[model samples]
Target: MKNNPVNTDLPLFCPREGCVCYQSYDNKITKDGIYITKSDMVPRQMFYCHGGGHRFSETGYSELFGKHGSFKEYEQAAKLSTYGISANATADVLGRDVRTVEQWQKALGSKGQQLHYFLCLHIGINVLFLQMDELWSYFKNKSRQLWVFIALESETKFWVSFELGSRTICTACRLVKGLRRLGKWGDDHILKVTTDKSAAYKNALANIMGDIQYAYLQIVKRRVKRRLVTVKKFFVKGMAEDFSEKLRTPPLLRD
Candidate 1:
C-alpha cells in the first residue's frame, strides 16, 4: 500500500518594492493532515495596475538583491548570508538558489554604474568641492576605492561637474572632461576648487586653469592630524582680481 501525506499551508510575501506582511495559506491536503508554507517558496512575478482599472499580471520584481526576484526574500537572506553564513544557509532560509545570491550582487554592480553615469552628466554651479575617499568591501577583500571630483555652485548646491576615478591622472582628466561637458570649462566658470594636496590634482588643475589668462583660482590643502609637516597649498591667480576676492572663504565644512 502507498503511504499518503497530509495537506499543507504556506506563507507568502508580496515581492514588491516596499511591501511587508506575510499571508498564510494552505498548500496541499493528503491522507495524513494539513501543512503550512511560505509564498516565496518560488520566484514571484509581480504586475502593475495600469490604466483606470485594477489589472495585474506577472511582470517582474526589482533586483533588491540582484536584477530580478523578490526584494524582501533577498534582504532577509543577505542579513543572514553575511558574517560567515554560507550561501547555502541563505538559500535554504529564503528557499532560493545560491546562484541567485551571486546574481543579486551583479545586479547591484549594474545599478552602481548607472548612478555613476548620472553623477557625471548633471553638474552645475559656481564652486566645486572635490573629495577623494575609499569604501571597504568585505567580499572583495579590498576597498572599493574612488576619487570623487565635483564642480558645484556654492550656494544652490547645483552640481556642475562630477567624476569617479581609479587613478589620480584619470580622476584629474575626468574633472576636466566633466567641466568641458557642462560647457563651463572656460576661465570664468570656476570660482574656486578645494582639494587635498595631491600632485595629480595640482598638475591637472594647472593644466586646465593655467591656460586661461583671466581666471584666478586657489588650491587649499586640509592637513591630516598625525602628519608633522603641513601640505602646501596651490593657487593660480588669474588676471581677474574681481573674482579673486571671493577666494578667501573655505568651501568645505570644518570637521
Candidate 2:
C-alpha cells in the first residue's frame, strides 16, 4: 500500500475520472465499519455509495491501500527531492524503498505536467506577446546535451509552450508551432515575438508568420571580452527595413 491518500472532509465526486456523478448527485456514502490490518492492527476506513455501487477507502480509490507507507511519507519524499536531495537520500530519510520514492516522484511530475497543460488550455485569447528562449543542459556526465526551447507570453508572463530537442531549425519550428496552436494571430489579433539572435529563430518565425500578423525581433548583445556589452535590435519579420535603418529606431523596431 504505497498510495497517497487524499485528505478530504467530503467525498466531492467519484474518484474515477470517467464517473458522471454531479456535484448535486445524491451519493449517500455510508461508512461500513473498518478492516483492521493484521500487521499493525491499524483500522482502515471503508466507504460505500449506493449509487453506481461505488466503494472506496480513505487511503485508496476503491480499495484499502497504503500497506507500506502513508501519504505523508509520499509528500516527504517529494519535498526532499525538491530540496536538492537525491532519490537515495530521500528514501533513507523516509525509510522507504528507493524505487518507491522514485516512482512517486515520477507520478507527481506527471501530475504537475497534466495540471500545467490544463491551465494552458484555459488561457484565453488575450494572452499575447511571445518570447522565445533556449535553455542548454546536459544529462548525467555531460554525455548527452539537451536543448529546451521555451516560449513565453511576455505580456502575461505565462508559459506558452516548450519543446525538448537539439538546438536546430526543426526544433524551433516545432516550438513555434506549439505556441501558434494556443491562440489566433494576425490582423486585429496582434502578436509581438521577441527572441535572441539565433538563426533557428529566423527560420522558425519566417516559416510560421507567412500569413499571420506578427512582429519579430532579435536582441543582439555585442560582447567585449568578459565585461559589459552594448545591445542592439535586429528585425526579423512582419516589417521590412534595411539593417542600418532597423538599428536606428530601437523602440520602433519591436512590434
Candidate 3:
C-alpha cells in the first residue's frame, strides 16, 4: 500500500460522531492510503484517526464526501440554480436526471447553510448603514404566499441577515432580532436603517432595538399602473440631520 502524504495546510480532525476527539485538531490523524473512484478516476487520500479508532476519507465532514459524481458537475448545477435556472431545466442542460439534480441541490444547500452559520451567524459586525426589504414569493401556487426579508450592509454589500415566512410582524421581529444579535454598537455609533414603508418593520424595530441609538428611514413609493411615479422619505426615528450627513456622503466615498 502506497502511503499518501497529508497536506499540512489543512487541519485534520476526526469526523466520527460521539468520539471524544470528534472535530478536534489532533496529531493522531495520519494519511492511510489512496483510492480512486471509477466515476472520476482521481486518487483521493484516506486517513486513519487513531483517537477515534476509525478510518475516513479526506472529504469527510464536507459536501464532497461519499459523492461518486464529478465535482465540476455538482458545481455547475449549483451555479445554474443560482442563476434562476429550474432544477428540471438544469437537468436537461447537464444531461442529468431531474432527481439527480434535486439531490445535488439538497446536499449543496445543506453545505451552504452550514457555511453561512459558521461565517455569518453569531459574529459581531459594526454596521453603519443598512438596507432592509422584503421580496414577495410563493410556493407552488399564488395562494401560498411567502416573503423573503433581507437586511444588507450598504458599504460592504454584505448580506447581514434574512428570514423566510409570511409578511407579518412575527417574521419582521425575527429579522430585526437577528440583526440586533449580530450587530456590535459603540457609544458613538448610530446605525442607519432604510426600508420600505412597512408598519411591521417600524413595530419590530421599536420592539427589538428600542434602547439602541439608531436612525430609521421609510421610503414610500407611489406607483401608477405598476410604474413608480413618486417616492417620499420619512424619518421615523433620530434626527434628520444625522441621516442627511450619512446619506450625503457614504462610507466608501468618504476619505
What candidate 1 gets wrong by more than 4 Å, as runs, is 1-68, 73-99, 115-127, 132-171, 174-189, 206-232, 236-255
The candidate with the higher lDDT, 1 or 2, is: 2
lDDT of each: 0.47, 0.66, 0.77
lDDT of 2 by residue, 138-202 (tens): 66668799888888766445677889999899999999888777666765755677788899988
Q: Looking at model 1, which ten-residue stretch has the lowest summed lDDT?
A: 21-30
TM-score of 3: 0.81
Candidate 3 error regions (>4 Å)? 1-10, 26-33, 121-124, 183-188, 224-228, 245-255
Best by lDDT: 3
Off by over 4 Å in 2: 1-51, 56-85, 92-95, 123-125, 155-157, 183-188, 222-228, 239-255
Question: Candidate 1's C-alpha lDDT?
Answer: 0.47
- Each candidate structure's TM-score, on Cα atoms with residue i matched to residue i, is 0.41, 0.64, 0.81
Q: How accurate is candidate 3 locally (lDDT)?
A: 0.77
Per-residue lDDT for 1-255 in model 3, tens only? 023553336477788777888988864899999988765666778999888788888677776676656677888988998898999999999888898888888888888776665545433356788878888888879999899888888766678788999999999999999877765743478888888889999999889888888888887777687666776889898767767764732222111
